[model samples]
Target: MRKEQRVKKNKEFQEIFKKGTSFANRQFVLYSLKQEEAQPFRIGISVSKKIGNAVCRNRIKRYIRQAFLELREDVQDNHDYLIIARKPAADMDFHEVKSSITHVLKRGKVLKKTSYGKNDRKK
Candidate 1:
């Protein structure tokens, strides 16, 4: 995650945990909250010690970062996003993590619906 997106404190995490909306799949839980300022979306990726040792946690964080790198375009506006890696996420390969993030984005309505909606079909 970028420097702006990283929620490096106990207080910010607490605020989001208390107020942000959350959704989860097998690999990750996504927490989101809106920001008043007009900046692009920001993100935080968390991998706890319960999930693994330092090396393992680093690997998982890397995968999460890669997923976010690919997904930034879709998610990079309007809200703040946090991705908490599950134990399963640490063990899985990159593909699984990517798919999980995509699912979370769709569930969170971060992915835009196509313009070709039912009304557009009439044209």
Candidate 2:
């Protein structure tokens, strides 16, 4: 995850929380807000003490960053996304976390669909 692709400032997070649309599942909650100008995607991950200790929280953040990196192309650019991990997320593995975030992004309509539908089977 690049620094430029991260939502690091406190004010930035607050603005997104105030203006963003949110979606959630058992594992995580996603808040997305479109930016005014064209820019790269900025992502933030939140895992509080209620979820775990420092090591556990950091692990979850890493998983989220990796998941976001994988899904970067599908994700809408010029937006800020905040991912808040739930208690169940602490027990989940990388794949689970990836699925969880993708689900939320789909529900939030932030993940762009391919023009060629899934039914177009490869020869």
lDDT of each: 0.78, 0.87
Model 1 sits at a Cα RMSD from the real structure of: 5.5
Clashes of 1: 0
- Residue pairs with backbone atoms closer than 3 Å in model 2 (clashes): none
Candidate 1 residues lying further than 4 Å off, grouped into runs, are: 115-123
Which TM-score value belongs to model 2? 0.92
List model 2 lDDT by residue over 90-119, tens digit each.
998998888788778888988778722232
Where model 2 places Cα greater than 4 Å from the true spot, the runs are 115-123
Each candidate's number of clashing pairs is 0, 0
Clashing residue pairs for model 1: none
User: lDDT tens string, model 1, 1-123?
Assistant: 568766677777778788899998888899998888898777777888999899999998888888777666666476777889887877788877777788887888776565113222454
Each prediction's RMSD over C-alphas, in Å, is 5.5, 3.0
